[model samples]
Target chain A: MSFEKVEHALHKRRKSRNIGLGAVLIGFVALVFVLTIAKVVDEGDAQRAEQALRINPPKASE
Target chain B: MSDASLNTTTQDGDAGFGDFFALLKPRVMSLVVFTALVGLLAAPVPVNPIVAFASILFIAVGGGASGALNMWWDADIDRIMKRTQSRPIPAGRLSEGDALGLGATLSVFAVVMLFLASNIVAAGLLAFTIFFYVVIYTMWLKRWTPQNIVIGGAAGAFPPMIGWAVATGGISIESVLMFTIVFMWTPPHFWALALFMKSDYRDAGVPMLTVTHGRTSTRKHILVYTLLLAPIAIGTAFTSIGGPVYLAAAVVLNALFIKGAITIWRRDETQAEADGYRTEKRFFALSLVYLFAHFLAILAEAGLGQFGLGGWA
Candidate 1:
């Protein structure tokens, strides 16, 4: 293959890879966001559950 | 064209500390650290803050070690693929021998120190994580089958469980849920990237979804995984570390994730090509946030618990 043809092919390959990487990076950000939100909310509820159990403990069987 | 000529040419490049560090794949390391920290904090058992810090640091080092080993093994394909070509070994910044040495040293140090500082179970889990990532994922499964990431993702999912083990000295339902969230999330997250980067895997001779199964099958797989992931992500709300706040976050984030997956599924290849890969791009980005938000919500719930508020046990 000619030098120019090889260069063109390399360029095309890089472009495709770039698109794929971009997609991957974006997906990573989305997953991080979802996880972060869940982390924050779960922590909150855990605190409340701790309090609720302390204040209004479960009843024992008669 | 000889091997000597190729080696000589490759050896001419610079290989500094920065280059050596690049082999660790810091982006992936950060995710490992964050999830592991969440697991440590969310556990019902109390751990000394100093010990907790050390455990997390060791876990991060172990994760980095795994990445280096992966780079060492995949150097050949990394050289061929555009995306991985700039990695330390592939870019000729570091030799494969050096990567292997560094990865091996860190792996041993991380495991031994984790065992001393925490417990045997956590140490064993860390060791298995390194072995799984290096042996099962990188060397064995990667080239052999398209299901590589799906199964090998267990290595990535182990950190949080390891962290929980460190805190509690054993696995629990909460830790398992943490593991499950990442396990189910991996396929769709990776497949989205594979969809747009199909040619790289093709060039590298790796059997990724886009290469082995075709783009249509890959897209359908992403949607299917996302469908399963949405429920699991929401189900964490019912656990000991879960409550109303987490449930709310799960509902919203999962809705967005499902919508993104549907958008990806509905788009034809021609449209994807014409739009310069927008749908796949959006879904991939959302997947990152999807994971981070889940962990951050857990942290938030934990913090609220300290103040005698929120609804978790």
Candidate 2:
């Protein structure tokens, strides 16, 4: 190939498998949304568990 | 530039998806992820599982961003160095501008995502780590000073602390100790490699410890840093993330590390070269294992802590 053609090819050839990169970016976005929900759910669970512990006084004796 | 036979695209350009990914330095990113995971898991507070996952992922991304930017900036020196000549930027698979763009994008993305997933503190620390690595270390200190790795080591040391912040939403002694462990470990670990690979830094004009101070000074520094590292390594056993399992592991590891350092300190370059730098090479390899084992032991202690059977009184 000619020199200029090779230079053009160099840049063009770099990202052929960008499908996988796209998928990963999508996955990252999905994970962020999932984590927001998980935090809410986990907080709710913690509150319920705290209430239960208070009522039951579930402490181990030293 | 002397070897006549190797000519493909004239070492100029052309690469695929793998080249871009290679620019991220996945190996270093994995270490960042592992240490950050241990820090998160070992924290006293519980994090939402998905949040924890996201936080670690962002931290990895941030670390990768640092690597990419470093590669972009260091491409010139990298091309001259045998050890680093094949990196994406240096190998001409990716342009320096492309690396800089990707790294900047990832740095912002990771930090913002971390803030969304965890807390501002974690995200802030991640941003700082990335900046310190790319700007302070790669762009500035690396060429200017021999002690580049010492202060620059803070960038690598921040992940666990960032992980701690992800879980607890704050820093504490435990997280600080984790940060310090990696920080103290960096000088000796890198200088050991410097002992054997001084030629690379010399040729690259990168001002590594060996290039500036000579092998003898580097050796002494390694032994001194190892001595400084031992107490910290063993002392972590009494911390929240440590237990008998950790103490035992650390004791054995540190003893062997000290032995290795002493041997390296005692050896002259002639002796080292005569044996093909075997002692230095062995020490360098062991340093990797040593750091990983320490982190793994901390993780083990965390598992035991979960069972109410860990930590010293």
Candidate 3:
């Protein structure tokens, strides 16, 4: 291949690679969103558990 | 205007203190410092403030030393990798010999200073962390196996445990859990970067997951490791160091981490390539926040406990 053609091919490959990386970045943002939702849900459970523990301490067998 | 001017310009092109410092990988060092500080703060034993500061400083120095040594050894391959091409040694700004000398000096200084500031066990762990990163991980595993990051992750995990030892004078389940969180987190985190930087690793002849096993397999491994990391991270909440703050962070971060992995797994190479590896880059960035958030949560819990308001206590 000519020098210009080789350079063009390399540039194309780099561009494609950059695009691939961008897709991954979008996916990561979506994942972060999902996890944030999950944490909100879990926080509710933690609060409930705290309330339960406070209201009814474990029975003792002295 | 003369030959002397030319010589001066050539000398200026060579690396000085700033270049050598970059080789120490300050960003990685910061993460090490943050996690180690969390470990120290979360320990049940009360350490003197001065000693605690000194010990953590030594640990950070130890981490930097490890980075420098890694750069020294990996300079050859680094020159071939585009992502690492501008690094000090690889860019011809700093000599490999200088890196070795600096790394060796810092290694001794960090370890000996840690010994003075803390107990023998903490100091020993710091020494071993440096050895593992430099000799075992960098020298042997990085070139020899695809599981390099998996096994080598232990070196990064040791800082927190060492920090814990610095305060408590021994290891505990809590410290081990902190160690496990980072250890489990490393593979998925690094694999995401590997997926996008596949060509660089291939060019450098480094057997990263994407280069050796292929991108599909690398994505699957990332998903698998992230799945494993979720439980380990959440489970920390049941430990002494865990509280509402950490539990909240873990639950949120792990969910996001897993979702990210799954998205990456689902995408075809063409689609991902079209998107400029967006998912991959996001995963790598999130991985950074994941670790920092977890440690920050631990620190928050410790602070709350000090104020007599923590549920974990």
Best by DockQ: 2
- What is residue A1's positional error in candidate 3, in angstroms? 62
Candidate 3 wrong stretches, greater than 4 Å: A1-62, B1-6, B10-14
Ranking by DockQ: 2, 1, 3
What lDDT tens digits, residue by residue, belong to model 2 across residues B1-313? 2222234452333467777789889999999999999999999998777788888988999999999999888888889999998887777667988888889999999999899888899999999999899889888898999999999999999999999999989999999999999999999989988888868999988889898888999999999999999999999998888889999999999999999999999999999999999999999999999999999999988888778877775
Docking class of 2: acceptable
Worst window of 10 by summed lDDT in candidate 2 chain B: B1-10
Give candidate 3's iRMS in Å, 1 decimal.
16.0
At residue B170, give the lDDT of candidate 2. 93
Across all candidates, the chain A TM-score values are 0.73, 0.50, 0.63
Please give the lDDT score at residue B303 for candidate 2. Answer: 83
Error of 3 at B32 (Å): 0.9
Candidate number achieving the greatest TM-score relative to the actual structure: 2
- Model 3, B155-212: lDDT tens digits are 9999899989998999999999999999999999898888887688888888888888
Model 2 root mean square deviation, Cα atoms: 5.8
lDDT tens per residue, model 1, B1-313: 3343333333522344456667788999999999999999988787766578778888998999999999888889999999988787877657888889989988998898788668899999999999999999999999999999899999999999999999999998889999999999999999999888868999888899889888888888888998998888899899888888899999999999988888888888999999899889888898999999999898888778888775555
Poorest 10 consecutive residues by lDDT, candidate 3 chain B: B4-13
